[model samples]
Target: MLDWVASLPLWQATIFLFVVVFFRAQLTFWLGKFMRKGLIKSKFGKSGQNAEEKRAGIAALEKYGWPVIPLSFLTVGFQSVVQLGAGFLDWNWLKYTLAALPGYLAWGFIYAFGGLALFRSITNGSIGLLIIALIVAFLVWAVGAVIVKKLRTNG
Candidate 1:
């Protein structure tokens, strides 16, 4: 998949990626909207009703506002949550799209260039480099996980 995308013309690939990201955020937003009512009626809904959760979410919104949309793109698994949260909170469409456009472009560029670079490194038999990259990635993940854990616990 990376190879196929990397082989496309730069502009074409970027457009394709931007569309994909846009649709993904839209889909997630709608999903959240659809699920919010149902989830709130469920047994697990108490968590969302908690004062702490509400306060934390509000604090985050006050601190980050729409910027979280773009920042979320840098994380691997949290973008969906951010998009869904926007919908659940009833964020304005124009604001969400405006924030997400740059994020999608950044995501496109990163995937296009980084994917191609990784592909080249693999094809060139740079096993040691790949291993080192994997190790570094693992360490980063570990540190991020710890930080998130601490923040959650502290908050």
Candidate 2:
């Protein structure tokens, strides 16, 4: 089933990307809002000046918004957070969309084209490259998860 889907034409892919990006942006926006709420309720944040702190968070989010899109591609939960943060902080949605779209395309091309290139190179050789790829992806996810968990727990 997925193989059939994978063989989709360029138009399908484009539409798919659009839909995915739209929903993802919405999700990110809400995630930021909820995270703000959670932070407010948390012990560390509760004792502080809530309005000032919220404004600071919003400011920090706007300042560092675009980079988060690409960084999220590598990290555990960055994608959603970036979306949410930008949304809650009222960053220009158009700019966020533009920045995130190219980053997403670059990421897809890197992984997809890289995989195909690797396969072509390794066609008559060993499976070491494939194995290494799997291992690296796993390690990336694991490390990202740990970092995200730690940040959430401590922040």
Candidate 3:
């Protein structure tokens, strides 16, 4: 898959990425919608601490609105959660789609360029560089997670 994508023109690869990410996000949103009822009844539903967490999630979404759609892309696992919350909350479809455009574009750029670069580096026998890059990526992710956690706690 990486080879196939890497062979494409940058513009084509970016477009392909945008389409895939956008559709995947939309699919996740619909899945959230479909599971809304079950989610309400399940463990993370309206019972105990889960209820408070749910309320917090809803409040965050409400506080941020459509901007959250795009910002969600920056976080690894949280994007789908936000999309699900958007669907479960019944946010306007047109607004969600429109707001998602820039997010998807950013994702496309990152994946297309970054993936290609990583693929090339690996194929060229640059394992040491790849290891360093992975470590740096992990550190960045860890820092971002900590910052997000602090924000969530303080907000």
Candidate 4:
């Protein structure tokens, strides 16, 4: 799969990345619809609840929705999970798409170059450098994930 992705031309790669992100966003929306209701029931449905509890759920969902689309590239299962969470919270599809575009672009570029860089480094016997680059990429992804978490929490 990595070889196949690597073989794609730059334009094709960009288009593929965009399509993946867009479809993933839509998937999140659909998944959220069912899960949010279940979550609401689990949180406040079983017992007599005030309006405040419902409000809290909505508020949490709104705050977190933006980051889900952007950080979808970092965490293994997290990208899809966040998208679903946003959808369940009833976030606007447009808002999610906007937040996701730049981040996905960044991720796609990094992945494309990173793949080539790693292969070159290893082929040239710069194994140590290759390892370092991989670590750096991981760190960058980690930082991106943190930003996403913060945005989701504070927004």
RMSD of 2: 7.4
TM for candidate 3 is 0.61
Candidate 3 local lDDT, 5-29, one digit each (tens): 8678888989999999999999988
The sequence of per-residue lDDT tens digits that candidate 2 reaches over residues 47-133 is: 773566456555555554467666665433445655665665556657777767765665454334333445456644557656656
Model 4 is weakest, by summed lDDT over 10 consecutive residues, at 45-54
In candidate 2 the C-alpha lDDT for residue 119 amounts to 49
Candidate 2 vs candidate 4, lDDT winner: 4
Pick the lDDT winner.
3
- Local distance difference test values of all predictions, in order: 0.72, 0.58, 0.74, 0.65
User: lDDT at 141 for candidate 3?
Assistant: 80
Instruction: Report the Cα lDDT for candidate 3.
Output: 0.74
- For model 1, name the residue pairs that clash: none
Task: Please list the residue runs of candidate 3 whose C-alpha ends up more than 4 Å from where it truly belongs after superposition.
Answer: 39-60, 115-155
Report the poorest 10 consecutive residues by lDDT, candidate 2: 107-116
Runs in model 2 lying further than 4 Å from the true structure? 41-46, 50-61, 74-78, 84-95, 104-155
- Pairs that collide in candidate 2 are 28-83, 28-84, 32-84
C-alpha TM-scores of all predictions:
0.61, 0.48, 0.61, 0.57
Each candidate's number of clashing pairs is 0, 3, 0, 1
* lDDT (tens digit, per residue) of candidate 1 on 1-155: 45788789888887887788889888898777678767767888756666676667555563556776887776565678778987776666787888888888887776665654764566576785676678657855774576466447646
